[model samples]
Every structure is written in structure tokens, then in C-alpha cells.
Target: MLRPGPVEQTATATAVSVGHLHQVFRDAYGCGPARAFELIRLARAALALQRNHLSLAEVAAEFGFSSPYHLSRRFAATYRTPPGAFRRTQPAADAMWPVRQAGLLPLAHLLP
Candidate 1:
């Protein structure tokens, strides 16, 4: 048997149905749990790019992405730039501060 994924586990832990969990996430974060998780993952990947010298494949593997190409696709879709370009241009100190300081709710903030 397969173990429950994070959203399902969260619903169980919180004593709510998965549907209710999704609803609550949507109400609080303007997106469902899956999307929130994705955003959090992407944000972390971006930070890794800024603060490390890991190759794209290493970064992708560390962050649970299937491959460097997959990471690039998602990163480009979200940030409008590829991971290599982001690493080259972004200052480590400013990796995510601007977005957070601008009042965008970081998905990780919703976690314990």
C-alpha cells in the first residue's frame, strides 16, 4: 500500500477531509494545497540557485525535481527565467526578500 502524500496527511492530522483541506488552503492562500506546495518548492529551488554553486541537475535532485530540464521548465514558467540565468543574475541576499517584503504570502509561511 502507498502512504498518503503531504496534503492527505495534513488532512488526516488536522481532522478534516481532503476536500475540506483543499477548501481551507484555497480560502487562506488563494490556491489549493498542491499549488501552494509547488510554489514553496519553487521558492526553495530559487534560493538554492542563488546561494550555491550546484549544477542544475544537482539542484533539481536536491529539490525533488525529476531532472534539470523539468526544473528549468517549471522555473521558467513561474519566474520567467531559467535556473542558470537566475543563478547568474540574482543576488543571494535578495533571492526571495523582495517578493516576501512586497506582501505576497509565501506558501512556506503557512506551514508549521
Candidate 2:
């Protein structure tokens, strides 16, 4: 997970103390800023994997990984499968009818 370096400018721009900002982030995200950033990046990667025809290397580069190997290592650690294998096992669109239909439900009901 990438840790943002030196967010002093961000703190100043927001006019919030860094410690207070971190506390708010922790309260809202249930994790520190770095982990939240990692989850956001992984979500982007997941979306790309599901919707794009890009290769794993391309996906890694697209999502700001240092290299394909780095992305593979971290993705596997996080998801318990290599990205290639995960992509290969995704259900076809037609098979996702129930889940797609669930979009009609209220967003609050969809969340755990």
C-alpha cells in the first residue's frame, strides 16, 4: 500500500490539524489513510479487471503499481488469488443477472 508522503500541504489547505484529520479518516474508513488509499486503488483495479481488456501488466501500470510483479504480489496477498486467475474466473455478464437486478434495491439495503 502506498503511503502518501508529506501531506502538510493538504492539512494546510484543508485548515484542519493533521491529527484531527487522521482521526476523522480513521473513524469514517475504519483504517488509516494508507490502507484506505490501498483499498481505493484495489477497487479501481478490480473495476478495470472486470470491464477492460487490458493485461495484468497494463492494469498494474494503470493503477500506479511500481511494476507488474509488484502488483501481482500485493494483489495476491490481498485477494488470495493472482490477478490473471481471478480475471479468468469471473462469471460471464449474462450469468450476473440476479446481481445486476439487485441494483434496483435501495443502496442501504445492499450494504452489509
Candidate 3:
């Protein structure tokens, strides 16, 4: 069988639709690609909120969301709080994640 490249990976995220490729994503992350997308997006959002300089809209844009309002809606739905408020008031431990500086050592590791 031929191996798929990056675009195909995003296009067909479910194993039901893409065969073994979906399995690959699931195997690596222990979740379906769809779920993996949400998981990673939320994780990255948490890290971004820690900066406090960027608004939820900006964070959404930085993360490739379609729009600020869209980001606020989804982010709030998944996280159960508005992005702006969350940025203002998340617990330190939850806010801290492995951040990569110079592309080494994720900041998440620094958390207690």
C-alpha cells in the first residue's frame, strides 16, 4: 500500500473514511483524528491564554480558526468558559504547559 502525505491526513481524518491513516492518528494520540483536533486545539489555546496579551480572537487566528467569533463560540463550548475570562483567571498549573523555546523543551514540563 502507498503511504499518504500531509494533506490527505487532514482531509480524511476518520479511519472509517481513510482506512489505516486514521488508525495512525489514533494510534499516536489515543483518540480519533476529530477528537485529536479538538484536544490539541484546546491545549494550545490554554497555553496561548497564559500570555494574556492576545485576545481569544487573536489566539483563534493564530491557531488557524476561521474567525474570532467562531473561536469564541467553540473555545467557550469546549472549555466551558469565555476565552477572555479564562485568560484572565485560569489556575497556574492548568495554564502552564510544555512550551517550546528555541524549539526545545515544551513549557508544559515546567509545571508542577
lDDT of each: 0.72, 0.61, 0.57
Best by lDDT, which number?
1
For residues 39-71, could you state the per-residue lDDT of candidate 2 as single tens digits? 556555766787878988888888778888987
Q: lDDT per residue, candidate 1, 36-108, as tens digits?
A: 6666667778888888898989888877788889989988887887888888876654555433633345545
Superposed model 1: Cα runs more than 4 Å off: 1-4, 97-112
Error of 3 at 58 (Å): 1.6
Best candidate, TM-score:
1
TM-score of each: 0.79, 0.67, 0.59
Indicate whether candidate 1 or candidate 3 has the larger TM-score.
1
Pairs that clash in candidate 3: 97-107, 97-108, 98-106, 98-107, 98-108, 99-106, 99-107, 99-108
- Alpha-carbon lDDT of model 1: 0.72
Q: Across residues 6-112, which tens digit of lDDT does each residue of candidate 3 receive?
A: 53565554333465656865666555555545445555777778765876667777766778787778777767777777777774635322223122133223322
Candidate 2 regions with alpha-carbon error over 4 angstroms: 1-6, 92-112
What does each candidate score in C-alpha RMSD?
4.2, 7.6, 8.6
Off by over 4 Å in 3: 1-17, 27-30, 91-93, 96-112
Candidate 1 is scored at a TM of: 0.79
Clashing pairs in 2: none
